[model samples]
Each structure stands twice: as structure tokens, then as C-alpha cells.
Target: MDCDVLIVGGGVAGLSLAWRLSPSRSVVLVEAEGSLAYHTSSRSARQMQPSYGPAAIQELTRRSIAMVEGISERLPAPIMVPRAMLTLGTETEVAALVAANANLESLTHSETMERSPDLRPETFEASALDGTAMEVDVPALLEFYRRQAIGTGAMVLTGAPVTAVEVVASEPAGGTDAEGAGAEDLPTRFHVTAGRHSITAGTVVDAAGAWADVVAAQFGARPRGLQPHRRSVAIVSTEHPVDPSGPMVEPADESFYYRPDGTHLLISPCESVPAEPGDAQVVDEDIAELIHRIGEVTTVGITGVERSWTGLRTQPADGLPVVGFDADVPNLFWLAGQGGYGIQTSAALATLAAGLLTGTLPDDDGWLAGALSPQRAGLG
Candidate 1:
């Protein structure tokens, strides 16, 4: 098959980009798994914390939240629901958080207990509340992107693991053939073999979550030293009745986090252990540690784990996403190394990527463009 763009991952990043680009370009998205978003995207904590991540990521997340809210009325269900994030910590930690986020409300011990009575009073000296946080309906958002992309003419293929990528032709410096052919007659740049399908396209995007670097190497592009870290989460039933309206609880130190999930609680150790690219497994020890930590800080006893899972959050050396075209490989673009911020920043990243691909990005956004550039200094 021939296309203008070939996206080599069907996670939120690839799907969102396909949705944005399919209106003006012939796009083909291929996923190795039998289903889209079968990895990190599906295993997310499903919360959009605007204050989270680095400055660049926070800006992208804010942009993405607005975009999602704009489309909420059209979706089958609301994509975001108000869920304040209550961060518990010592007085020093709370002070630091207050200094960093202007919107965060510093909470005294009494105020913290008023918001979440389950928290142990003596464990934390103070806390902060970010009322802007929201619980994201990840499935709804993913389906919206997938349906929009397919509806607009993008072909999405599942179980199509790419086996080989060959550079069919070198792009000229001026971005056309030496003969100066018309746009419709431009030379193909990549020939890709994935499972039972063969594809040729003018551009290739590497959005493979944990295997992003592996995919880049397959295309003869330099690996960006992306590291995949395993984060484990578990759902456990509480001994007491969980308050559905209670805020999501997390420590300022980020050792762990927990939020109400129906009658149970969704909890994570917030661990970032380096891992290889593959399906991650939950470590019993990690869950044990998480339970112990919760016991020290909360009165809501976890009776037993109802379910547990793990996912890989990929990150570059500097812990920022890699966007824009590859500096060394012509016609190759990167949309990887989003780490844990992928879902929250998908829309903005997709918009930025589409602009970069089509050369229509506003000139005023140069700072952002430079920040996310694949060749930016300190990033592999």
C-alpha cells in the first residue's frame, strides 16, 4: 500500500496524530498488538494533572485539556470530570509545592483532614490541593480519536508488527526530486514490511511506546537512548466505605498515589524502575510496599488486591518528549519519549506534530518547537 504518512504505533500519540493529519493526508497506522492502546496508554492512571511534569509538558497538557473540553459535548461521555488532587507532605514539601504552583491551595492539618478523613493526622504536617485536576475517561478519548481517524480516511491496522524498514529514496535538500516533480509525483521515501502487509510512504513516524528506540534503529535512525520504566498499579477493596467525592490522594514526594474507584481504590507505587520493551508484570513486592506506605499514612485499610497491572513509561535522557523530524534521517519524524505525560498532552503534541509535518506551524511558537525538537541538546 502507498500513503503519505505511515505511523508505526497505535497508542494515543499515533491515533491523535492520525486523526489530525488524515483530513489532509493519506495516513496509515500500524500497531503490533492485536488491539490499539494495549500497553501504556491503556494502563494509565487516567488523571490529567495540569501541574505535573516539566514546564514544557505542563503547557502542552493545559493546551490538550482545553482541546478535550471543547469536544466533550460531542463525545459519548464527558472526557474529564472534576477530581481534585490532594498532595500530602511535610511543611517544607507543602511550602515548595505552593511556591511552584500558584493555583495550589496550601492546606493545614485540619483542612487536610476535613477533605480526606482517612488520612493519618500525624503522618503529614501539611498538604496542598489542586482543584484543577480531573479524572480522564481514557477509553472514551481513545475511541473518539480512533473513530475520527477511521472516519476521515486513515487506515488503522492491528497486529501488524513492523519487521523491516528500508529507505527507498533520499529526499532532496529542497524536499523534491532533482527533476522538480509536482507534489503528487513526489518520490516515496520509506518502504516498510509489517507482518503480512507491505507499505510505501513519503514519511514515517515512530511512536512506539516502549519500543520506540528499537523502531528507530530498524529504520536506520539513531536511537535516542529512550528508557522504559515500569510503573505498577493495583485496585484494592477498602475496609471502610470509600467516599466517592473524596479527592485523589498523593504524597508530595510522589512515593505513591491513590484515588477512589467505585467501591474500591486505585493505587500505584509511582515506581520508575528501568525495564526492557515488552509487556510489564506487576511485582508483588512493589504492591506490598505500596500497601505498607498507605497504612502508615491512611486509615482506609486495603483488605486485598482485586486486580493489578504494570505499564512502561518511556523517557529520553532529559525526560521530555521527542517531537519533530529526525536530524540525521530524512523523512523520519519522532513522537516518542512522552513518559507518563502522553495522554494528558496528546492533543497538543498531535497538533504540534501536524504543523511540523505540513510546515504550517506559527512562527511565534519557535520556543516550543525548539523545546520539543528531536535534536535538542541534552537529549539522546
Candidate 2:
């Protein structure tokens, strides 16, 4: 089969971009897993906090807020629920927290206690709340993207593991008089093979999460030194009753974090250690550390263990998403290295990436283009 674009990976990044590009281009998306979002996309924190992440990610997420808020019109179900976020800091970290984000409203200890009585008042010397934060309906959002892409004539292949990507300088069989190029002289095209299916496309987008560099290498593109960090989360029952509606809580330094998950609490050690990309598993040491850290910030006691899991957060060397075309490989676009902010920034990033791919991006978007460029990280 032939398409104008072939997207590698069926995570939120690839699905959303296919949704955005399908109306104007013949698109085909392939996922290695049996279903969409079997990895990081499904294992996200599911919070829409534009304030979290790097400068470019912050800009993308901030812009995505509008799209997320208005997404109900496009999807069959709502994708967000109102939830507040509190970033707690010690006395020494107050100034740094405020400097890092001017939007963080300084809250008194009394106010913090009133907002979340479960937190140990003495352990937190400063508190700030971002009222705009919300719990994202990640599954619903992924479903919407998948459905829309298919509905718009894009082929989405799940359980289709891409085994090879052949990139070679080849001309279109027909001469392109507009480019003054003969049938023998044109740029390259990508021949992608997934399972028993083969697709030829003028462009290919890498959105393979932790396996992004692997995908690039398969296609003869330079690997960007992409690193996958293991993040573990645990769910445990608390001895003390917690308000189900309370704001999500975390230390300003992010040593550890816990949020009410129905009657229980979901906690994370805030760990991001480098790991090989694959199905991630929770380690006993990480869970033990999480329980110990929770005791430091909260008065609640863990009564019983419930469950735990781990996921990979892929970050490029420079720690920003690598978007835009490969500077060295013609027709090779990149949409990887989103780290933990992939879901929150998907709407805006997909729009930006689709626009860049089609050459319709506004000139003023050059700042964003430069920031997310593959060359910026020397991945070219």
C-alpha cells in the first residue's frame, strides 16, 4: 500500500497527528502493541497541568488547555474533570517555587490545612494551588483520536510490529515538472514493513515513545540519544479517611507525590531513573521508598498494599520533545521525546507537527519550530 505519510507508533502522539493530518493526506499508522497506547500513553498521570514541564512543553501544554477544554465538541465523551493541584514546599524552597512559576499563589499553612487536612502542616512551610489543573480522561481521549483517524480514511494498524524501514533516494515514476525534476531525480521515500503489511510513503513520522531512537536507527536516521526513565506508581489503602475531592498533592521539589484515587491514594516516588525501553515493572525498593516518603509529608498511614505498576518516560538528551523534520533525512519527520507531558501537550503538539509536515505553519511559529527542531538536540 502507498500513503503520503506513515506514522510509526500508535501512542497518543502518532494517533493525534494522524487524526490531524488524515483529512489532507493519505495516512497510515502502525503500532507494535496489540492495542493502542499499551505503554506510556495509557500509563500517564492523567493530569492536565500546563505549568508542569520544560519551557517548550509548557508553551505547548498551555496552548493545549484551550483545545482540551473544547474537545468535548469533537469527542463522544468528556475528557476532563475539575481537579486542583497543590505544590507544597519547605521554607527554603518557597522563593524558588515562586520564581519558577509566578502563577503559583502563595498559600498560608492554615489555608493549606483547610484545603488538604491529610497533609502534615509542619512538613510543608509553603503551598501554592493551580486551580486549572484537572484529571484527564486519557482512555477516552485516545479512543477519540483512534476513531477519528479511522473515520477520516486513515488506516490504523494495531498488533503490527514494524520490522524494517527502508529509506533510499528514489524518484517518482512520473516526472514532476513543477520541481523541474526528472523521473530519475527526486528526494527519498520511506518503505515501511509491519508484520505482513508493507507501506510506501513520501514521509515518515517517529512517535515510538521510548523506542524512538530504535525506530530512527532502523530507518538509517541518527539516533538522538533518547533515554527512557522508569517511573513507578503505587496504590495503597490509607488508615485515615481521605477526602476524595481533595486537590492532588505533591512536594514542590517532587520528592514524592500522592493523590486521592477514589477511597484509596495513588502515590509515586517521583523517581525517573534511566532504564532500557520495554515493558516496565515496579521494584520492591521503589515501592518501599514511596511508602516511607509518603509518611514524611502526610499524616496518613498505609494500612494495606493494593497494587503498583511502572512506565517509561522517554526524554531526549536536552529534555525537550524532538519535533519537526530530520535535518539530515529528507521526508523524515519526528514527533518523539515527549517525556511525561505527552498527553497534556498532545493537542497543540499534534497541530504544530501536522502544520510543519504540510508546510502550512505560520512564520511566527518559528520560535516553537526552533525549540522542537531535531537539529536543536544534534539528532540530525
Candidate 3:
């Protein structure tokens, strides 16, 4: 198989980039599992909260705000649903939220309660609002990108793990040509083996999400740092008649948060523990911790834990996604390390990935340019 770009992971990172690049380039997304995005991407918090994480991460997320706010107006009508976000904290955390947060420009008790009426001020010392925060239809959004990519000639292959990748000179592999037929062109090419089948492409994208570090190493990439961590969330039966329109909440310094997922609420410890990325499962201790943290905020308790799961959020030390060609590897691109913000930041990231691969780097979105560069993480 011949392709202009080979995307390793079929998660949000890989699928979004492939979709964006497919209009003018031959992009192939390879997923190790039988289905696309079966891992962390599928197991997201399923909400879009713009404010959180490090400065660089915030910048990328800041770019994503407009996309979230105006999803219907921009691409699709229902990708992002309006569900105001609230950040509840102690007095000190409130001050921190107020001081550095332009995203949460205005704060008030009435305003805060408007988003999450169930918030109890007696328990929380202070609270603020991220009025811009909203719930994202992550699966729909992923499918939107996938449909766009396939419609534009991008090929997606599931149940295929890239076993061996030998960087040949540069030739063609699989997939339809300009005339819509599978063909290969050029001399020596980068040979990528999936199962027993071989494919080639001009450039390969390491959007393998948690497995990105391993893929990078296999492709002769020596990354400065590619860190992966595990975080868990529990979908419990709050069986209480909670408003579906309730805003997402982070209690007293974001120790934990609960987002509305239909009648049930998605509760998480908002904690990240260092771990090697792969198949992740929920731990009992972590679940206990999550329950304990939620108690500190909500008067209502987890009546029942319908289900629980865990996933990996891979990132660099400096905490921004890598969205361009590797600093060392010539044809390899870094579209990994999105952490928990992958679904929210996919649109902008796809643009960055496309621009970087085509030699047209993105313009300075003010502080955003320096934030997204891998150099900040010492990867450059």
C-alpha cells in the first residue's frame, strides 16, 4: 500500500489528522485493534472544558474554544452542545482561578449556580465559571472527521498493527491513485508491515496516542520525552433527577470533577498517575480515591457505580501536543501527546498537522506558536 501519510493510531489524534490531510493527500490510518478509537479516545470524559492543564495546553485549548462554541455554525450542527463549565474551589483556588483566568472572565455565585444549581457553597470556599465550557459529542466528532477523510480518498484500516516499519528510500505503497486505483510509484520506499501485508508512504504520522512513544522508537526516533499517564473515571448511577443541562464541575482546586452523561454522571478524580501506555483498566484503589474526592464537593453521593474504566493520557514534559515533523526523523511527524484534551483540540491540531507536513507551518496564534512547538519539551 502506498500513501502520502501513514497514521498509526485511529484515535482522535490520528483520525483527525488523516481527515484534514485527506483532501489533498493520500492518508492511511492504521489501528491496532479491530475497531477505531477503542482505547483512550473512546473512553474520554466526553466533555469539552477549555480551562485546565498547563499554559501551552491552555493555549491550544484556547484555540479550540471557538471551535467548540461555534461547532454548529462552523462544521456540523451538533458536534458541541452548550453546557456551561464551572470551576469550584477553595478561597485560594478561587483567587487563582480568578487571577489567571480570562476564560472564566466573570465570576459570581448566582452566575456559578446558574450553570450547576446543585453546587453547594457551604462545602466550597469559592467557585468560578468557564461560561465557554461545553459538552462535546466526541464519537460524533470523530465520525465526522472519519467521514470527511474517507469521502476525500483517505483510507482507514482497523485490526492492523504496524508490526515492522523499514524506511526504504521513497516510493509508493497501497491505496487508490489520482485516477482512483491502487498503485505504487517511485524508487526505494518506506516499507511498513501490518500483519502479513506491506504498505509504503512518503511520510508516517505517529498519532498512536498511548503507543506513540513505542512507535516513535521503532521508526528510529529518539524523542526527548514522551510521557504517558493513566487516569480513571467512573460512570455511576446518580439515579437522582439531575438536570441534563447541568454544567461540568471541578470541586475545590479540581481534585475531582463530575460531568453529566445522560441520567448518570461521569465522576473522575481528575488525577494523573505516571504509567506505561497500553491497555488500561480501572483499579479499585483509584476508584476509591475518586469516590472520596467527589464526596468533598457534592452533597449527593455515588449511589451506584454502573461501570468504570481507565485510559492513558500521553504527553511531553512541557505539556503541549507535538504536531509537526520530528526534530530528528526526516519523514516522521509527531501528532501525539494530546493528553486529555485530544477531543477538544482535534480541529486545530489537524490543521497544524496538515500545515507541518505540507511545509506550511501555522502562523503565530500569538502565544500559541511557541506553546505547540516540540522544542518547548526539549524534543527539538
Candidate 4:
């Protein structure tokens, strides 16, 4: 098979990009799993916080909110639901809290207690509320993008893992001679093999999430030192009647967080341990650490762990996503390393990437385009 673009991952980033480009490009998405979003994309915290993560990510997320909201309108069900954010802090964390929120206001222990009754007031000296955060319907969002891409004639293949790629460079188009090629310059092509299927495309995209660098190496591109970090979450029964409308509660320093997940509360240690890329399972020790940390700030008691799971947050050294063409590989794009902020930033990041590929990005997106370029990571 042949296409204009061959996307190597079916996660939100890859799916969203394919959807955006398929209107004018022959796009084909190949997933290593039996189904789409079987990894980090499905195992997310499922929250959309515009002010979260590094500066570059924040920019992309801020730009994505409008796009996400717009897409939500077209979906049969609501994709975004309002949910405030509350960060409990001590005096030592005042500077960090202030830096994170310019308009942060001090919440007295009494006021904080009133907002989230489960929090142990004595453990916190101050608190701030971010009213703009929301809970994202990840399943619906992913489905929307998938349906849009397929409707636009993009082919999606699951359980077909790309194992090899060969880049072929030849003479310019429509200029050839018997002895030697005329022009002697042309764009490269990628021949990819996935399972029993073989595909050729003018451009290839490495959006394999945790396996991004591994995919890069298959096409003779140097790895960008992308590291996959394991993050675990535990869903436990709530001892008290937790408010479903309650804001997501965490320490101002973000050591751990616990939020209402139906009648149960989902708590996490916010741990990021380096690991190999594969199916991730929850660690008992990590869950114990999460419980210990939550006990430090909340009065809730975890009687039982209903369920637990783990996901990989692949991050580069700078903690920003790499989203441009590889500096060394011709026609190969870099669209991985989104960390934990992939879902919230998918819309804007997709648009930005497609714009870069088509050379039609607006003047307003120049900063983000440059910041996420492969050159910023010293690959240029």
C-alpha cells in the first residue's frame, strides 16, 4: 500500500494528526496494539488543566482548550465537564504556588476545610483554587478523532506493529536519464513493514509514545534520549461521602493528588520511575507510598484498593514534546514525548504539526512552532 503520510502510532497524538491531515493527504495510521489508545492515552488522569506542565506544554494546552471545546459541541455527548482545582500548600511552598498562579489567593484552613471536608486542615497552612480546570471525557474525545479521521478516508490498522523502515533517496521527480538521474535531488521515501503488511509513503511520522526513539532508530535516525517513566494510580473506596463536584485536591508542591472518581477517590503518588517500554502493571510499593503521602494531607482512610493500574509518561530531558521533522532523517516527523499532558494539548499540537508539514502555519503560532522544533532538542 502507498500513502502520503504513514503514521506509526494510534494514540491521541497520531490519531489527531491523521484526522487533521486526512482532509487533503492520504493518511494511514498503524497501531501496535489490538485497539487504539491501549496505553498512555487510555490510562490518563483524564483531566484538562490549562495551567499544568512545563511552559511550552502550557502554551499548547491553552491553545487546545478552544479547539477541544469546539469539537465537544459536535459530539453527541459532552466531552468536557467543569471541575475546579485546589492546591493545599504550607508557608514553604508559597513561592511555588504564587509562581504557578498569578492570581492565587490564600485560603484559610477553615475555608479550605469547607471546600473539601476530607482534607486535614491542620496539615495545610494555605490553599488556592483554580476554577478553570475540567474533567475530560477521554473515551469520547478519542472516538471523535478516530471517527473524523476515518470519515475523511484515512485508513487505520490495529495490531499491525511497524518492525522496520527503509528510507530511499533518489533523483528529483520527472527528471531521469539512462546513464544517471537528472536534477540529482529529490525528496526521500519510506518503506515500512508492519506484521505482514508493507507500506510506502512520502513521509513517516514517529508518534509511538514510549517507543518513539526506538522507532526513530529503525529509520537510521538517532534517538533523542526519550525516557519512559512509570506512573501509577490506585482507586480506593472513600471513607466519607465525597463530593463529586469537589475540586481535584493535591499538595501545592504536587507530591501526590487525590480526586473524586465517582463514589471512590483516585489517588496517586505522582511518581515517575524510569522503565522500559511495554505493558505496565501497578507496583504495590508505589501504591503504599501513595497511601502514605495522602495520609499526610487528608483524613480519608483507604480501607481497600478496588483497582490499580500504571501508564508510561515518556518525556524528553526538557519535559516538552518533540513535534517537528527529525533533523537527520528526511521526511520523518517527530510527534512524541508528550508526557502526561498529551490529551489536553492534542488539538493544538496536531494543528501546529500539520501546519508545519504543509508550510501554512499562521504568524501567531510561530513561537510554539519554533519551541517544539527538533532543533530545540539539539538534534539540528
TM-score of each: 0.95, 0.94, 0.88, 0.94
Clashes of each: 0, 0, 7, 0
Model 3, 101-200: lDDT tens per residue? 7777545666666556666656665577777777778888788789889999998999889999897754245555677643334433468997655788
Lowest lDDT block of 10, candidate 1: 179-188
Determine which window of 10 residues in candidate 4 has minimal summed lDDT: 97-106
- Give the candidate number with the greatest lDDT: 1
Better of 1 and 4 by lDDT: 1
* Candidate 1 clash figure, as a count: 0
Candidate 2 contains a number of clashing pairs equal to 0
Model 2 TM-score, all chains together:
0.94
| Tens digits of per-residue lDDT for model 4, 249-289 | 88876878888888788888888899999998898988987
Give Cα distance to truth, residue 46, candidate 4, Å.
0.8
C-alpha lDDT score of every prediction, in listed order: 0.91, 0.86, 0.76, 0.85
Task: At residue 144, give the lDDT of candidate 3.
Answer: 78
Q: Model 2, 1-380: lDDT tens per residue? A: 99999999999999999989999999999999998899999887788886687777878887887887787667666778767889888755766666787556778789989999988777878788878777888888888888888999999998888898787666666656776776557677778889889989999999999999999888778888889999988889999987888888888777777888888988888799999989999888988977987887788898867988899999887788999998778888889999888998999999999999999998988999999888884643
lDDT of prediction 1: 0.91
Off by over 4 Å in 3: 68-77, 106-115, 171-188, 365-370, 375-377
